[model samples]
Every structure is written in structure tokens, then in C-alpha cells.
Target: MLDKTSPSLPRGMRYENQLAMIEGMSLADIAREYPTPFYCYSQSAIEQKMQACLKAFEPTGAKVHFAVKANSNINLLRLMAKAGLGADIVSGGELTRACTAGIAPADVIFSGVAKTDNELEYAMHKGVGQYNVESIEELHRINTIAQRLGVVIDAVLRVNPEVDAGTHQHITTAKKGSKFGIAYSQLDSALQTAATLSSINVRGLAMHIGSQITSLEPYSQSIQRMLHWLEQLQAKGFAIDRIDLGGGLGVDYGNGEYLEYSDYAELIQASFANYQVDIQLELGRSLIAEAGILVSSVVSTKQSSPNNFVLLDAGMNDLLRPSLYQAHHPLLAASLSTSARPETFDVVGPICESTDCFHKNYPMLRPNTGDLMFFTVVGAYCSVLSSSYNSRTLIPELLVNGENVRVIRKAWTIDEQLKLEE
Candidate 1:
């Protein structure tokens, strides 16, 4: 029997008759219909999480935008749109995807550090609601694009407050010397320049400290700094009306520790109660990470001197967080009926690179060849980061709504990939 009390498992995932089940369907059944090494998302889980997030931030009158970089699948984006969430996009393709997903262009906020001139013009043409300007150069570029289009554009200056997010360094974005946002010291001059731009309306300030942030202290510190600048800009006669608190809220990935949305909402209310400006949020992982899992079939198991290895069909190309960020995802066997004893395994993928290992020295029930296994809390970055490296075909993704399942993305075949080549 699966341990129902274990926090590592995704919500709504449990065991029935010693078989792993998602929602009301058995994983073995799903794997039989759809191939293994595919991603499966629970519709009910995502909807519940979204509703909770919306409720938590409702008191702040915040406009929540789902960061499209997390999981750009159009089906999921459509679900977010249906839930009344806007799109926080960073590329023209993402903007198109959001629009195609039925999110209004007025609800899109284009955010990135290196948007090209063509991208700026395209966003303007598509009527993107706001632009989070990373540098004075980008601000000038927006002004130029707006001038060429003969339309005024709404924009906000993204400031780096030099606050430590206390998360992984690779995901930390807003500290000093980071290439993400404008330097705090240069905000004054940036605003002065924006004041001279006739086609651009710099309405507010934006700041994103980092991703997977567990502590509220960093957010508190970053908000304090942003408010300081907001007050300074207002004092200087700038009509500052918005504060984009770019999202870095973390979710629990088997650690049983994460930032609560209620606490974050309380902090926002307490901090901005005196101010009358609009609040905007760009949330990504926290909303969807715990709603999906990657189900893979065990290919083989072997002992190599000091380490026991269990190989699966999925690789770093399919889920790169382990190799790229050293992220940990709880692995569980589909069936707990194995006669072999539980063992410590270095779960690995069939990739050519040495960095394709998922977990090291992990304790789990011994899985036999052809048995099903899954990695939890992978809904956000797993599918979006997949690559067709080493001639491996991209896997399919399925969304489950109770007993009904739908393939949201079709698997890429080797023939299709070869067709693109000579």
C-alpha cells in the first residue's frame, strides 16, 4: 500500500489495491493506453490550486498573471485563462500562445531582459498590456517602438534591489550584478529618462527577487525597497500607480516546507494597505508544480560496486531540472508488491551524458524491470524544458479529469525529427 500520509506524493495521487492511482484511474492502466515516460497532469489538482491562489490574493486586489515560461502547453494555458489568470510572457511566441489560449492581449505583460526590437514591435502590435522594462535601453526601445506605431505604451521599470532570495543561485535573478533587472542605484536616472519619452508611460515599478524562494524575509525586504522607490517616484511627480511584485513563491517538493499563499497575502495586505496603487503578480511554479508527475517504466536495475542503479526511459532531456539545477523529485514505484527488499538507488536516465542522474543515494522500494515509476512535483518546468537530444523523441503529455484522460501534446517521433533535417 502507498503511504497516504507521505507529503511527497502529488495531491489526489494514492494507491488502490497496491497499484498507484491518479485521481480515480490506475497508473498502470494509463501507462498501458499511453506509453510510459510521459507526463500526466491532474485537472482537478490544478483547478484547486488556482482557486486557492486566487482566494489568497483576492484581498490585495491583485491581478495574477501566470508566467508562461513555466509550462507553455496551450491546453494548460487555456485552463489558466478560464480561471481568470492573465499571461506573464517573455517572448513573442509565448504572447501568441497566450492569445491563442484565449487570454486577452490586454491581460498580457511582456517581461524579459533581452527583448529584440522586432519583439517589442510585435508586442505593441498585439496590444500587450504592460512591459516590464529591465534596463534604460529597453525602456528607450519601447519608446521607439511606440513612436513608430504612433501609440503610447504602458511600462514599469524592473529594479534589482540586491536582496538575497536564499534559493538556488542558478534561479536567483534580482540580486546586484544580476542581468535580470535595472540596478536600484540607476532607477532615478531611468525614471528621469522615461519622463522625457513622449510615447512611453512609465506608471510603476517591478521587482522579482528569485525563483523557489522559501523565506518571506526576502520578499519583505524587496517590497520595502520597491515601496521606497515608489514613494520617491511619486514625490518626484511621477504618476506611479502599479507595483509588480514578480512571483518567486516556492512550493514543497517532498521537503514538507514551503511558503504559504495566505501568509504572502497577509504580508501584501499589511505592506500595501496604506498605498492605493494596483498590485500585479507573476506566478509560475507554485500554481502548477504539484499538479503533475512524470511516469516512466523501469528499463533495468543493476549493482555497480558502491551504488545500485535503476534506469528509466526518461532522461535529462525530458526533465532537465535534476541535471541543471540539482533539483530533487520524489520517486515512487507504481506497485509495492516487489519481493525484493527496499534499497538505496541512484535513479538514472538513459542519456549519453553523465549528468543524466535524477537522484543519488535515494531510498525506495525495489522496482523490477517493466515496472512503472514516477517523479512528483514536475508540472511546471519538466515539459517546458524537454529537448530532443541524442535523437530521443519528445514524449507525450496527458491531462486527467477524474476518469477521463486527454492527450494535450502528442509525442514527437524520430521520423518527424528526421523530416526537419536533410
Candidate 2:
């Protein structure tokens, strides 16, 4: 189905102000047909986001490698591949999923700190675009695998420039002491081994500072430092053909003003203009977050101590951001009424864990039990990270295209879950 007008998501669906289409169908209608807890996607929103990203980075000669870990649903992957995007993978599973999605093996680039020998061997057999080596040991591993496979492997040294991305500490990587990439002090030994290892061709550099990075200064600093390193490599007669910057572009959960695609691309392009090298970027959250939202029904509500609790049918088992990162997702009542007085409610889920709360200071207009709720900005990490904890059935995923909607992932059946039980 093709979307005509832009989508206007219900509040808490993401960046509150964007127009929400609900796929030209009502959220209540979708819930009634599919069941209480399910996932809904906006075809137009995803396409628009990709368009914006392409427009922003087109001037920089950059290729967008959709981070497969962000959302590995095969249907979503197929849509992205059709859009001419490449894949940025970190594991054998992601690489397999990308290939299953019809992404060319040569278009895939692997990035991670600890790739096992088997993962490297699998990637080499697939003739993946490059192996982003994080340490000298990894380089040796790649060479070892390539030698056994009788194929040359291309590699990019993932360097730690020590730039702070000002995001959450758990996700922060490129910091000097972080366990992500090689320290600057180890580069000489790495390059020395790389030059001698005929099985591995070290052709590029890669860096991923952190996740949810909304600032430009950190990126600019990282790019400048990387370029200087590349220049040094060129001075040493090592052929460096590209720079793969791992993507951590943050989506506007509340503040779209903080993340602007144009400004971010402009900062990177201006700095890299001196060099005529190919560039690739791997992005996940920023591309898919707004296009998807979770629909859940408020099962009941009660007064607890000094606060009102709105219990939802979905929980951290369905969406783990709250439990994992202490992340706050916006929540909105689908059947909103202007006349009803708004109230502050702690939006929670049925999971037994006390930490299974979506938002503690959640704002709500008057809402009743059985009212549908929308959890915005969940397109990236939500569904892919869901679990069967408490034996909860997996949420059904629906694809909405204009007035046409179809179920891509049917809700998990009890029998299906039991099939795996011993």
C-alpha cells in the first residue's frame, strides 16, 4: 500500500508534533482486529525518514548501512534493501538476515569488537564488503580465517579517538577507556602486522563513538581525528580507500530540535571535503524509530499511595527500554477527549517486576480502562528485543501502507511457544 499524506502519530508515538496517519485506519480498529497488544508501522514515515537521510548525506558521497541490530524483521529489511540502502552488521545472525533480505553480500560491512573466528569465517565466505577489525587479535583472527578460506579479507581498523558523544554511559563507546576499539598506542603494532599479513587487506578506518548522540561537536572531533590518521596512513604508503563511520544518530524522542539531519551531514561533509575517499555510515534508531509504535490497551487503573497507576497489557517483556536503559517513552491515549481534565499517571505494564514501567511522570488526558495507548519512538530496539518472559506471547506486527494493511508477523501462538519447550 502506498501512503499519500504524511502520518500524524498520536502523542508519545514520537516527536509528538509530526502528523500521524495510522495507515489511514484507526488504532482502535487495528487492535480490534489483531488483538490488544501489537506493533503498527507507518510505510510513509519510514520512507520519508530514509529520504531525509539520503538528502542530508548525498552531498558527502556516503552510503547508509542500515544497522541490522536496530530492527531485524525480514520484512523491514526487505523494504530497506529495496530503497538501495546497504547493510551494517555486527554478527553472523545479522549478516544472515541481511542476505536473507536480499542484500548483496558485497554491500554488507561487519562492525563489532569481538567477532568469533566462525563469524569471521562466515563473513569471509560470503565475500562481505569489509571486516571492521577492533583489535590486533581480531586482525590476526581474520587473517587466519582468510588463509584457511583461500580468500583475501578487506579490513577497517576501528580506532578509539576518545571523543565523548554525551549520550548514556552504558552506550558510550569511543571514550579513551571504553572496551570498543583499539587504543591509539596500539595502532603501530596493528598496522605493522596488517602490512605483513597477506591474507588480510587493511583498506579503511571505522569508528563508533556511542549511541543516542545528538551533538555535532563530538562527531566533528571524531571525523577530524580519523582523517588525520588516514592522512598518516597515506603518508606511510598504505592504501586507505574509505572511512566507515558507525552510526549512532539519535532520534528525537522528545526533542526533534536537538537532532537535525542537515546540520549533522553538513558538519561531516565540510571536514571530509579535502579527501576523495568513499564513505559509509551505519544508522539504526534514527531511521526506524518514528515509523513504528506499540499499541496496548490499558487493562486497569488504580490509586497507589500518592500516585495513579495505569496498568497496561504490555510490559518490559514486550518493550525493554524502560528496564534496560531507564529510558522514558512517550505514551498517548488513542481515544482522547478535550473536555476531560488531564491527569498525571504512572504508565506501567503487567510484568511482575517493579521496574516494568513505561513512564513514571507520564502525562495523560482523562483515559479509561480498555483505552488504546500508543508508545512512540519504539521502532528500533523494541520488538527485536522482546522476550517470552512470564510466558508472554510475542506481539503481532502489522504493516500499514496507505489504506492497505497486512500482518507481517502474526502474534505468537501458545502452541508455537510450547513447540520449543522441552
Candidate 3:
């Protein structure tokens, strides 16, 4: 049995979602069948967001390269691929899965700080679309690998503009001192070295200052830096063809800041109108953030002096962003979502680790035992970041398209977790 409250959904989301109500079924029914502590994604929402992104960015002739680090569920990947979105891969495993999902090798872009030689060889052999070259040493390594394989590798220099995107310190990756991209000073020499290498074709420039960035200032700074560097590269007699603007769009995860897809696209579209270079946007969070929800049940509620904790079945194992970055996700009693007198309570999960907490000292209306909780804006990093700590079985995943639903990834059993150990 469960209590009834309005679902804590995003601004335009439906409680009895069109996807949820199709064929007279609901999210709760799926949860009942699959049990608690699972992930449910809306395929319709994904398609809707993708369409929005495309419509918003086309003016600039930009191509969307969906970042695989978001939610790489194979079915979801296939859906995105079929939607004509290019892929941005970071690992050999991701590259392999991108192919398995039917993404064309030429439509995949590989980017990571520490790509192994074997991984690079595998990607190059598979003919990945572009390699986001991170460091000068990486450029040398790729050239060596390409030379050995009797092939030519196309690559873009990932330059660090050292712009500070006021996001979590862990996510602001474009700083001068960060390990992500080449420093400004070292970029030109890097291009020279690549141009001199017969096995490597220098195609473009790329940079992403940081993640969960809500403001436009940091992006503008990064873009301005890129444009200046781009001019410098062009002036030096280098033929750079593409501009890879890395992904860093933020979402309204109770951060009190919500960005519109149309506006973001319009801004970029305007910027691109002035530049004729081939452009790419490796979008991840912005495309999928509003498309899914995490459904967890309140098994127990505790009230101590000056503190309250709602013990949820979902933990950091289910959604690690909260514990990982001290991030917040919108939460409320799924049954009592419309209650006006919501109380503030710490939301914690069942993982044995004390860091498994979801929200601490957050205000919520008085929610009780057996009440379902809906964690909003979990569409991006939730399932993909899940872990099997404490030997917990992987949770089942349900994909919903309209009122239609399919159990994409099934919940784990204790036996399944121990099968390998035994």
C-alpha cells in the first residue's frame, strides 16, 4: 500500500503523464511489478527534448553529438542514434556500445583524458568520427598509433581556455591548471606537432569549461577564447575546419535556476551565423535532464531532536550525484505532492555508507511511511552512475514511450550480484 500525493515533477511535467497513463497503466504499477529502487526513463520525453534541441540549434548548422557519459542504456542510445544524433564517446567500451546501438562509426567522437593505446587503436580501427585530442603527448601517441596501423587519424585539439564556470569545483574542468585540456600556451606548438605528423589530420578545436553551468558568462568567455584561438590557428596557415563546443549545460535540480532549450539554441544559433566553420555541440545533461524520474519508496521515517530523516530505498547506489557533488534533486511525497505545509526533512538512502544521503536539511512537507517519493531531474546521471556496492543487485530499468512501457533493464537479484563472487 502507498500514500497518495501529487508527483513532484518539473514545471511542465504531468503527474499522470501521458506516458504513464497510456493503456490505463501508471508508474506505480510498473514499480509494483518491478519492485522498489529502480530507474524509469521516458522515451517520449527523450524524443521531445531531442527535437527541441535540434529545432533550437539548426540555425547555426550545428550537429548534436550526444555525450555517452550521461545515460548510456543501450536502448536509449539506440533511440538517440535513430533520431540522427551523433555520438560523443569517452571510452573503448562506450565506443563498442555506440556501434552495438547502431551509431555509425563515422558519427562517433572519442574524448577522454587517459585513453589507452589499445583503446585508441580499437577506436581508430573502428574509424571513429573525430578524436578530441586532449594533450600534446596524446597527439604524439595517436600519431604513433596511426603510423603503426598505416592509417590517418582525424582529430581536434581540446584547448583549455581556463574559464571558470561557477559550478561545483569538481565539475569546472576548463581551468588553466585542470588536467582536461591543453593549456593556452602549449596549444600552438601542439598544432605544429600535429601538422608535422603524417598520420594525424588536424581538423578542429574543442573546449568545455565545466559542467552544471547555469550562467552564460563562463560560456561566453570560453567561446570568446575559442574564437580568438581559432583566429590565431587560422592566421598561422593551419586548416582547422570544425568547432567542437563541448557540453556543459546545467539543469534545474533545485538550484533555483532553469534554462530554456530554445533560448540556449537561439544564442548559439546567433553566434554561429557569424562563423562559417562546421560546428558540433556535445550535449548531454540539457537534452535528458527533464526527461526522467527516480521512483523510491519511503520504508521508514525517523524523527530525532532537531532533525528528521526519511529512509528511502534508493541510495547513492541509485543516484550518486547528490553524494558525489552535494547536489540536490527535487523531492516530495509522490502521494502528497500538492500539500502546502510541506516539512523539511533529511532524505537518506539505504546504503550502509553514511555518505549515501540524498538530501540533508532540505525542506519537505511531512511525508510518512509507505509513501512513495519522486526524485526529479534524475534523467541524466542516475542509472548510469549506479553501483553494486554492498552486493546489491542492479536495479531494473523501465523505458516509457507515451503510455507504452518496456522493462529495458531488469532489477537485480541477490543471486545475480553473488553469481560472479561464488
Highest TM-score scorer: 1
- Taking all chains together, each candidate's TM-score versus the true structure is 0.98, 0.94, 0.93
Using lDDT as the measure, the top candidate is: 1
TM-score of 3: 0.93
lDDT for each residue of candidate 3 in 287-342, tens digit (9 for 90 to 100): 78777778888888898879899899888888898889987887755453554676
Q: Residue-wise lDDT of candidate 2 within 1-422, one digit each (tens)?
A: 11223233422232213323385777766777888688888887888888888988999889998999999888999989988899999899999999999999999999887888888888888889888889998888888889989998788899998999998887899888889998978877889899999998988888998888888889999999998888988898888888988888877675442467788888878888889788889999888887888889889898888999999999898999888998767676666566877788888899999999888767677567788888877888899998878988988888888777789888886679999895
The residue ranges of model 3 lying beyond 4 angstroms of the native Cα positions read: 1-8, 11-13, 16-24, 337-341
C-alpha lDDT score of every prediction, in listed order: 0.91, 0.83, 0.81
- Model 1 agreement with the true structure over 47-96: per-residue lDDT tens digits: 99999999999999999999999999999999999999999999999999
State the TM-score for model 1. Answer: 0.98
lDDT of 2 at 297: 88
How many residue pairs clash in model 2? 8
Candidates 2 and 3: which is better by TM-score? 2
Better of 1 and 2 by lDDT: 1
Which of the two candidates, 1 or 2, achieves a greater TM-score against the reference?
Answer: 1
Regions more than 4 Å wrong, model 1: 1-6, 338-340
